[model samples]
Target: MTDQELQTLVEKVSQESFRQPFCHNARFNQRLKTTGGRYHLQSHDLDFNRLVFEKYGTAELIKVIKHELCHYHLHLAGRGYQHKDLEFKQLLKKTGGSRFAPLLAPVVFQVYQCQQCQKMVKRRRKIDTKKYVCGGCQGKLKFLKTIEA
Candidate 1:
C-alpha cells in the first residue's frame, strides 16, 4: 500500500481498536530489514517494512500494524510502551499482535548435476567435487549452483 493508504489504515485501526484517532503518518519503509514495523516517538509516525507486506501479505501486515499501534497508543497515553513492560505485553496479547517478526528460512542447499548422465542432485551441505560421485551412475558430479531459502 501507499503511504496515504497506510495512514488511512492506521487511523481506521486506532479508531476501531483503541477508540482513539491516530493523527500521524504511516508509511512503507524499504530500508527496514528485520523489524515488521516501528513507531517514532518524536514524530508519532508509523514506519512499516514494505518487504513484510509484499512477502507475507495482508494478514501478516495487520499483525505487524497491531504490534506497532501498541507502541503508538501506549506511548502517546504516557503508559508503559516498551516490549518488556507488563502493560505492553497485556495490550499486545489483547490486540493479537505478533510478539516477534517471522524470519525467512536459511539458504544452505547446493545443487549439483552429473556431467555424464545429466542427473540432478540437491545436497544440504556442499560436497567435495574430487571425492563425491553421482549416486545413479557413479559419474562425475559437477557443481551447478547454490540456492538460498
Candidate 2:
C-alpha cells in the first residue's frame, strides 16, 4: 500500500484501538530493516516497513500498526511508553499488538567447497576461487550453490 493509505490506516487504527487520534505523520520507510515499525519519540511520526505487508500480508501489518500505536499513544500521554514499562505491556496486550515481530527469511550466502579437504565455506559476497584457497589444506576451492542461512 502507498504512504497515504498507511497514514490513513494508522490514524484509523489509532482511533479504533487506542481511542486516541494520531496527529503526526505515518509513512512507509524502505530503509527500515528487521523491525516491522518504528515510532519516533521526537516527531511522534510512525514508520512502517513496507516489506511487512508484502511478505506477511495486511493482517500482520495491522498488528504492527497496533504495536507502533501503543508507543505513539503512550508517549503522547506522558505515560510509561517504553517496552519495559508495565503500562506499555498492558496496553500492548490489551490492544492485541505483537510483542515481537516475526523473523524474516535468513540472508542468502555464497557457498564454496574445498576440492581436496571438502571443507565448506560461506561468504556474504562472491569471492574469486583463483585467489582464495581452502584454509584447511590450501587446496583449490570451487564455487558451490548459494544457500540461505
Candidate 3:
C-alpha cells in the first residue's frame, strides 16, 4: 500500500483498537531493515517496513501497525511505553499485537573448506582465504560456495 493508505490504516487501527486517534504521520519506510515498525517518541510518527507487507502480506502488516500504535498511544498518555514496562506489555497483549517482528531477510553464509584436511566452515560474511586458515588442520582455506538461510 502507499504511504497515504498506510496513514489512514494506522488511524483506523488506533481508533478501533485503542479508542484513540492517531494524529501523526504514518508511512512505509524502506530504510527499516530489521524492524516491523517504529514509533518516534518525539514526532509521534510511525514508520513501517515495506518488507513486512511484501513478505507477510496485509494481515501481518496490520498486526505490526497495531504493535506500533500501542507504543504511540501509551507514550502519548505519559505512561510506561517501553517494551519492559507492565503497561506496554498489557496493552500489547490486550490488543493482540505481535510481540516480535518476523524475520524479513535471509542470512547468507560463505562456505569454505580446508585444502589439506578437507574441513568445512561457514561464515556470515566473506573472509580472505589467504589471511585465514582452517582452525582444525591449520591449513590454507579455499572458498567453496555461498548459502542462504
Q: Which candidate is the best by lDDT?
A: 3
Q: Candidate 3 lDDT, tens digit per residue, 1-149?
A: 89998888888988999998899999988899999999998899999999999999989999999899989988998999999999999999999899999999888999999999998999999999889999988999999999998
The lDDT of model 3 is: 0.92
Best by TM-score: 3
The residue ranges of model 1 lying beyond 4 angstroms of the native Cα positions read: 104-149
Instruction: Give the whole-model CA lDDT for all candidates, comma-separated.
Output: 0.88, 0.91, 0.92
Candidate 3 accuracy as TM-score? 0.89
Q: Write the per-residue lDDT of candidate 1 for residues 12-70, one digit (tens) a residue.
A: 88788778888888999888887888889899998998887788988888888888999
Between 1 and 2, whose TM-score is larger?
2
2 versus 3: better TM-score goes to: 3
